[model samples]
Structures are given as structure tokens and as C-alpha cells.
Target: MIKLLSLLALLWVYMAVVGATHTADLSRKSFPKGFLFGTATSAYQVEGMASKGGRGPSIWDEFIKTPGAYFSFFKHLLEDINLMVNLNFDAYRFSISWSRIFPNGTGKVNRKGVAYYNRLINYMLRKGITPYANLNHYDLPLALENKYLGWLSHDVVKDYADYAEFCFKTFGDRVKNWMTFNEPRVVAALGYDNGFFAPGRCSKAYGNCTAGNSATEPYIVTHNLILSHAAAVQRYRQKYQEKQKGRIGILLDFVWYEPLTRSKADNYAAQRARDFHVGWFLHPLVYGEYPKTMQNIVKDRLPKFTKEEVKMVKGSFDLIGINQYTTYYMYDPHTSPPKDLGYQADWNVGFAYERKGVPIGPRTKLYEEDILCVQAYSNWLYNVPWGLHKAIMYIKERYGNPTVILAENGMDDPGNLTMSKALHDTTRINYYKGYLAALKQSVDEGANVVGYFAWSLLDNFEWRIGYTSRFGIVYVDFKTLKRTPKMSAYWFKKILRKNK
Candidate 1:
């Protein structure tokens, strides 16, 4: 039975590759000159030498130790670089695993780990693909977590700065673009408030975890994360950036929250949601403090920065990477406040999928009999292209129109589909067409978006989702660790082709 199944899968894959089509609705010519098109992946997601190369375990490694609960890209650097070059991608944004460099999170440098990244970056440069290196991507070294409970304690700020400094001194020359942390908000909320990610912790009422105070921990973690970012930026500016001529930034995830209705209450609810989401990070970076809504609602629970700290935290980035994917409708929940308190509960708003029996957008397949909005493989991801425009504009109007990168913008399909169906990927192609158009519209209106990177280069591990969600233009055959360009890959090639 196993042999037969393998043979059938190979046959389908061959059919899928041969049947693939190359088509695109938009072109690179639609955007400003020097605007880059690239793909993104994280160290752990793509570099699958989890325990190899003298690397230590990350919190994620320990968190997902259950049998059959892991997957990765198997670290094919040269081949992956060649793939991106062939797709006409101009850049690659990838994370550096913290544990890979300092096995114990600090002190000794792992030579093997350093050599591997040097090779990867060098190869990318040789292939004319710019390297955008992100210092951390949620894979905190387990040693730090065990020692000082990771981001929860203030002690981590200096240690994290040290780690960032090491990376700056080492990789700052060839790698010109640097992002401190990817989605620190997600790190705070999902890892602390909901217990859904590694080093999972939450209030008993919020999620299943052995230890945490969801209401307070998320704020504390966020506060430290922000300080850590600021310290790293400070170090780079003082020590490395001027010499290397590089830029540093942080990656933030934003979900545009539209008012469920035009009523003042709904509008206020939407604003509150926005303040609590992207504003949670950007407000501090751009304005030197948390959003007023968060400060007022969370009150004493939200940590305050010292006067000196504010100076360092403010204006810490050369650019901002917005990892936008979806949007939601928010309205004033007229009911009384909840007895069980947490980061989400503190918002004092309610989420609604539809109003007056009509969804915010068209449905992909009429998801349920009643829910009309189109959705991706992930339940939370909805197909709403306008959200991208709104998200970029929100930063423009509110956050001083600082330079932005559409760091991650792509939808996923279920990973279980047969090879033929997966490679066809008409829906993924449409998703990109709609989104790229929306992004182009924003750029035309002066959003200062210099580049765009699709969510991934291959179907790799998706943290909590494991291997169940496919968010790659290049399909990977997990059975054989094979790489095949999906129709969307050819679509990108055609649109991004410079020779035309």
C-alpha cells in the first residue's frame, strides 16, 4: 500500500508540473523603479538542521516535541537561491535562529552556525538577490527561557541587545537590510495571552497552560520586546550601521479593523481595535509611547517607559515591515465588561463577520451557509484586498508615512490536496493579483512601500499549524523533499521579468 501510494503521488506531481500555466494580471512595470519583489522564510521554517551544526534548542523545539509534530525545509541553500533567482525575485527576507549562533543563548559563538549563514548570504549576493536579515523570529533560545523566563523579565533586554550586536558585527556588511523582530505583537499575544505558541503561557481562563497571567504577561513581554528592539537599534547605530551602510527595522503584523457600521460607536470600536493591534507596536516606535486607547484601557497593567527609555524607543527604525494578511469588522459590544480579563478582553469591542446579512467581501465558496466572506486555509485569513490598502494608508496618515515593506502578504491553501490540484493554484494566483493591485494603488497614493515579499518561498513548517497549511508559490514534496514551481511561481516570473 505504501509503495503504491508513493508511486501515485509521483505520477500526480509529474502531471501537475507539466500542466502548470504561466499567467499574471499585473507587472513590475506597474510600480515605481527600484521597488523589489521577493519571498520570505524564517530560519527554523526553512533551515531544518534543528539540532545540527552545534545549534541549541529553541523554545519552539521543546514546545512541539510531540510525535509527528514537526516539519522543515531541509536547508537547501544553493538550490533555494537558484529557485528565487529563476523566479526573478530581487530579494529574500529571512530570520537568523538565535540558538544557532549562541547555543546557550549567550557567551560562546557557534562557528558552524556563523559559517552556514555566511555561505547563504554570500550565495544570495552572488546571485544578485539582496539579503534582508531579520535578527529574531519567535525562536528564542530555550536556555534563556529556562533562565529568566524569556521576554517576561527585564534582564532579557541587555542579553537580547548583546545577541543583536553579535549579528550586526558579523553579518552587517553584506546584508544591508536588518529587521530586529518579526511580529513582536504575535510573540506577546499568542505566546503569552493565548498560550497558542512556543513557551506557551496564559491565564487559566484564557488558555491551556501550566503557568502565566495572560492579562499582565503580554504587556510585560511586549514592553521588554520593545526595549530589546530599541537597544539593538541603538547598538547598531552606535557601532555597526554607519560603517556598514545598512538599515534596521522591525516587522509588525497588522489586521485592518473596519467599523462594523458607520455609527460613532462602531467607528470608535474600530479605532480602538486598530490602536490595540498595529498601534500597540508602531505607536511606540513612531510616537514614543503606547496608543492612548491601550494606556487608558489596560491602565496600570500596561508597563510605562522611563523618560530616558522613551528617547531610545522612539524612531528606532529606518523602515517598517508590515506583515498584513486579513481584516476584521469590529463594533461596540454594548454588554458589560467581562469578569475574566486578558489582552483581548481589554479591547472592550466585539468582532462581527457580517452586517445586515452581507459579508464585508465576496465569498470564495460560501464558506458556511451564512458566512459570506472568502477565506484561506487558515480560518483567520479572509480574502480582503482592500484591507492591504487601508492598512498601508493607516500607517501613512497616522504614523508619518515612514518607509514600509509589505513583509508578508499571501494566502494559503490546504496542504492535503493532491499534487495536481495544488500546483494549479488558481485561487492563490487570484489572491496575489488582487493584493498586488491593491498595493500598487497604495504606492501610487504615496504609501512609501519600497518592496513586497510573499509570505514564503516554499511550503515549510507553519509553527502551530505544522504542515497543514500551504503558503508557498513553490510547492515542496515533503515525501521526497522535492521542489517544483507551482503555476503561481511562473506567474511571478512573467510579471517580474526585467528583460521584457
Candidate 2:
């Protein structure tokens, strides 16, 4: 009880420092007409029935068999969707697991797997919640990786298209909004370069893995991923975009990089990081080639797109999903040119959470209650809401303001915190309030922003860190799988209510 009271007191102080002074005079009406208010969840992060319903394995299935891996979330779809309805959300953005639909990757479709999503999607529309379906979210079918090394090979471009075409033919009638891939940069960098994600492969100089050429594989994999996205977009436009009247796009994660100080070197370094990060993908999609900076730095290692490939790869979307999270200060370290190289090392920049003792934002972590909790459950996600506004404007100015969706945004609370404390998540409430206000500000500034989806509807699983990190507005007791709405959830409900 003493601990509970202390948490409440800390939250009050934290709220005052960050965002409590700003009244949430904004609501769903605050956004543009036809702009949506929703929440997001990926299948792998929430669905646990990895082997059920004739589902085939994805690389994640094998990866989670690791000793510390937490077990699954597919059982609660109906209950979870119902929660969305009760919360007054306008839509739900979720992914279709590739292995679940085509277990062997390409040869045959899983009827049971298709039926499950059919039920979920149908129910979402029936309840007045729009269904925004994303085709892939990092869970590539394991068979594809085994057969042809997945994204590393050009073969993936065709296989991925076939799978996507099947999905369009099957589900496109009802699911009007679609996304091709989610965060392909993370797919290439973390999976191949740093080896933090599944299908982990890296050179010894980069990460722990049995065998991988970190310098080469990341570029090759990203090239193939770009081709895959373009191929899927082409197929959708040719076959289903007209008949079904559906829209397709890809989701890219962006971190706003502010220069640490007034130094020219720091500003240039920050630009370099931005170019290598989002520009790595967006430049190719927009202009049919890599950014000039990337071309000059990466040189021959970055693959060239032939004339036909370039035509297919460029201007390949009806919308862009931007997952903006936190911000960091970047500066050029001016280190000596590397001998043993890798993709990440190419950035040649330093990241600082603080400058001259002023912290970047708040660092709310597992046991740092002694100080103000600015760190979230994930070490990387500091609560810096203003970053969202800067990132959206950058996309507006840099990428032609193509229709954008704020796909994933929110911070996590430490899982070990007591349910009472976790439910009274005033910090999470203020986090959304500040970030959403920033989002609205971007729209007011003439950014072509279409919608905003909270990172999650409920806490399910956090990869690598397992269940230790909880990111849902609705709390889940991992032991019992019971769902409870935190204070943040009710706050969001009020904002999203149609009458408001």
C-alpha cells in the first residue's frame, strides 16, 4: 500500500513536469475530416498459437523457443476486438501473418488460417471499426528463408508478390486499407546487420551469429525488400486496386535526429543519420535510386536498379505509414575509416540522450522510481513527444507530403510494476496527450497526415525483453491473460469518442 501511494505521487509530479498543464482541449474533431483514430497490434506480438490451425512456422517461432522466451496471444482476438469497440476507437491496424496464411510460403494456402482472419475482419466492420490490414510485419515464413535465404535473394520478390496477390483476392473485398510491409529498415538492419532479430546473421565485427557478411547482407536484403514491396504494389494496382477500391502502402519507422549543438559538424552528422535511415528506403521509392549521400558513401555495394526495375520501384503507394517514436541528438564522431566494416558502422555518428547534463526527455525504466521516470520499459524508447511533430514535418518537406498515417506511437511501463500502479498509468496518459497534440500541430501546419494509431490496444508480448515490457493502454496479466483498461485507455476513449 505504501508503494502504491508513492507511485501515484510520483506520477503526479511527473505529469506536472511533462504535460499536465496542457489541457487536452483536442479530440477526434481536432483531426482533419476523414482522419481516423485507432490503435495498432502486430500478429506475431499478440498471436500465440504459432503451430495451430495448420499454420506454418515463421523464423519467430523458432527464435522464441529460446530459454527466456515467453509463450503466446492468438486466443483473445474476439475479446480484444470487442475491447476496441467498447473503447470507441474508429479503426484497428493489424497484420496478417505470412506463415499462417501460406504455411510452406508459396505452394498452398491454409484454409483454416484464412478463415480466422476472415472472421476477425468481418467482425471489425460489423462493429463500425475500420480494418487497416498490413500484409507483413517482420514474420516471414520460415520455409522461404530455408528455401532461398528469404530477403537476401531476388526470389523473394516473386514469392512475396504471389502471397500478397492471394491476400488481395481473398480479403481485399472488405479490407479497404492495406500496407505491404512494416519497417523494412528494421528487417534489414536488426535481422542481418546487428543480429538482434530472428534469422539473425552478422559478421563477427557486428553481432553474435554463426555466419553472415554484415557489410554485404544488409544492403542485399534491403534491395530485395524494396523489390518485394514494389512488386506487391504493382500487383495490387493492376489486379485489385481498381475492382476492390482498396489502397496499399508500406510502413516505415522514423526517429527525428536533432543536432546536439550549434556546430556545423553536428548538424551535418544529424543529416547523415536521417539520410541513411529513412532516406535509404524513401529515396529509392520516390526517385528510383538510393540517396546521393548513400550512393557516395556505399558506392558499388548498394545495388543498382535496372531501367525496368526502377520504373516498377518508384511511386509505388497510395499512402505512407510513418511510425515516429523518440528523438536523439546526433553528431559526427569523425572516427578513422573502418577496416572491418558493417552497415551500422556506416552511419559514423554519435547518439546522445542528453547534452550538457540536460536529458533528452524522460528516462522511465524498471526500477528508477527514485528519480523522475522518463524511460519506458524499452531502453530505446524515451518519452519525447515533440519528436513526432518534427518527424512529420520533415516527411512533409522532404517526401512531398504524400498521404501519411501515424502508424505506431506509445511508450511502455515496466511489467513488474504492481497492477494497481500500472493501471494508474498517468505517465502513459500524459505521454499520449503530449504526442497527439504534437501530431495535431503537424496537421495544422499543412502536413498531409491521414490518421493516428496508438502502438497497441493491449499488452501482449515484447520481443527479446519478453514480457518484462508492457506497452498496451489495456493491461494484461501474463499469468492469467486477463485484460484491464488503464487510465490511459479511458483517456484515449474520451478523445476518440465520435461526439467529442
Candidate 3:
């Protein structure tokens, strides 16, 4: 609680400094017509009914519950929809739990699971909230993981496509915007490289994970995820999309990399960070191959796609969803390459929050009282709002400004914050204000960003961090499952109303 108060104070001071320099004009009227403004949540994160209604256990069930425990959200279905209506949000981007849909990985359909999603979708539509359905977040079915090691095996390409096809056939009619996967890079990196996330896999050099070859598994997992994504896109284009008239895409997380100095080494290091982060996925989808920096560094450890896979993966999406939250400064430390190889080490660059004793932005404050969003737990989430501007501009300059969506952008507070303090949420409001101003500036400069969705709609279970982090605009009392909109939620409601 003291930490929360300190963060709130630091954020207030930062906002004052930012406001003095760049007056943010973030009214909804700034966006073009048809620009989507909404919030998001995933099934596993929010929908708690894990065991009932014929739903099978996901890897998260096995990993989080540590032995596959169950939970439920069935009773709150209508009440949640009613809450969305009250918020006056125009859209909602959520995910479908794979284990809930096909409990045993691929053979049989869970009719109860289907009915649950159908009910959720029907009610959202009835309440006039457009649904942007993502096929997968990080919740892989435990059955698949046990059978074929999940994403590491080529077998997953067909299995994932088969699952995606089931979804398209069933819910494509209602979901106009389809995202194949959310943050696959995070899935590969956090899950396989550091073992910080589910399934707990990492090389011994990286973490105390039970079993994983971080050097090799991250690359292998990413290759299969890319394949799975392309296959699903192909299925949609070849079969359902023509009839359904809906757009299909994938969600990627990007953190803008700024050079610590104007020196050539720092510039190159920054490029390498961007290449290893965004280019790891976007490059393949756009140019049919890995970025030159990645290709040169990762070498054979990075999987290569066959001629058929290349053609299928390229131009795989009608639009791309980028989840941007923060930025960092990268510099070449001139360090020797290590014998132990892992995804993070492959970058060959050093990260810094400051240079010459000056912080990158006010958000770089790491003082215990001033630290925001995971504190030093995640130093990368510094409040560099201009980074969003740079990120969108980078996409335009490099990737041809293809249709884009700011799918996820928000910071978290410690979950133990008092209810009154949580409802105030001035820091979160300022986060939206500053970031949206940056986004608006990017759009004004001819960046073809068409939509923006805040990182989340409601506070629920955050993966790994679990209930320890609160990133939602709406507050949920876990003890009673009560919903309370924060000041930011009311802010969005008012601004969104003004534009409409």
C-alpha cells in the first residue's frame, strides 16, 4: 500500500513534467470515423469457469493451478455484458480458451464450451459491443502439450489450424475481426527462454526451470507458432473469409528501441533490438524471412522456413495488431559473446534506462516510491509515451504502414491498492492521456493506425503475476466479484460520448 501511494505520487510528478512540455489533446474527436476505441480481456484471464460445462484443462490450468485445478465464470456472464454496456465501450477484444472449446486438444467438440462462447458473443452483440475474437492467448491445451510438446513440434501446425478452423466455422459469423494469436513472441520468450511464464521451460543458464533448451526451444517454438498462424490465415482466406467477409490477423507485442546515444554502435544496437523484437515476427509476415540482424546473429539456431511455408506466411494478415506498452534504450556494451546461448543473450546488446546519468524519461524513476507498474520487477515499462509515436512511425517507415491496431497499451498497479485509491487511478488516466496523444500525433503524420484498444477492460488474473497486478480500467473485488469503474473508465465514457 505504501508502494502504491509512492507510485501514485511519482506518476503525478511525471505527468506534471510531461504536461509542461507537451500539452496532450486526446479527445476522441481527433480520430477518423470508424476508428475503433475499446478495451480487452482474454478468456483464461477473466472467464473463470475452468472445469464445468465440459471444458478441458488448458496448459495454464496445469501450469497455474500446478496440477490442473478448475474455476468458473458462468454465473457472471450476463452481469459482465451489462457492465460493458454501462461502460459505453464500442468494442471488446477477447480470446477463446482452446481447452474450453476442444478439451482433448483435437478430437471431440465440447458442446457446453461452444454454448458458453455463443452465449457470451450473443449477449455482447445484443448489448451492441463489437467483438474482436482472438483464437489463442498463451493458454495451450495441456493435452496437446503432453502429447507433442505443444508449440515445439511441427505437428502443432496442423493441430492449430484444425482448431482455428473449428472456430471459424462456428463463430466467424459473429466475430468480424479475427486475431490468430496474441503475443506469440512473449509465448516463446517468457515460456521457453526465461521460464517466467507457464510451462516453466528454460536452459539452466537462464533460470531454475525443470527442463528446457532455451537456446534451441525459443527458436523452435517461434517457428511453429508462425506456421500455425499462417496456416490459420490460409484457412480463413481459402474458406471462411470470402463468405464471412471478416478480416484475419495476428497480435504481436512491440517495445520501441531507442539508441542510448547517437554513436554508430548504439544505433546498430537499437536496430538489433527492434529486429529481434518486432522483426522476429513482422518481418516474416511482410518479407517472408527473418530480419537481416536476426538472421546474422541467431544463425542455425533460428529455424528456417521451407519454400511452401515462406509463400504461405508472407502477407498472412489483412491487418496487424501491435501491443505496445513501453520503450527502452539499447546500447552496445562491447561485451564478449558467451558460451551459454539463450534468446536474450542472442541480442548482443545492453539495455539502459539512462545515459550520462540522465534518465530516458521521467518514467525511468526506479526509486521505491516512484517505481510504476511492477517497479523494478519490469524495468522496461518506463512511461515513454513518445515511444508509441516512434513505434507507429517506425512501422510506417519500415513496414509500409499496413493497416494497424494499437491492440494493447496500459500499465498495471499493485493488486493490493485500496478500493478508493484504485478508483482514483489518476496515474492510469494520465497513461491513457499521454499515450493517446502520441498515437494521435502518429496518426496525424500519416501513420495508418486504424484502431486502439486499452490493454484491458477489467482487473482479473494476470498471468505469472496473477492477481498481484491490476491493469484494468474497471476494478473487480475478488472476494465478492464486484465491479467498479475507475475514473479512467468514466473518462473514456465521457470522451467517447463527445465524439459520437
Q: What is the TM-score of each candidate against the true structure?
A: 0.92, 0.95, 0.94
Off by over 4 Å in 1: 1-25, 66-75, 362-375
The Cα local distance difference test for each model comes to 0.87, 0.86, 0.85
Number of the top lDDT candidate:
1
Q: What's model 2's overall lDDT?
A: 0.86
Superior by lDDT: candidate 1 or candidate 2: 1
Tens-digit lDDT track for model 3 on 347-414?
98999887798666555434453243322123456777888999999999999889999999997777
lDDT of 3: 0.85
Model 1, C-alpha of 15: deviation from truth (Å): 25
Q: What ranking of all candidate models by TM-score puts the best one first?
A: 2, 3, 1
- Between candidates 2 and 3, the TM-score winner: 2
Most accurate candidate by TM-score: 2
Where is the poorest 10-residue window by lDDT in model 2? 66-75
Better of 2 and 3 by lDDT: 2
RMSD of 3: 3.2
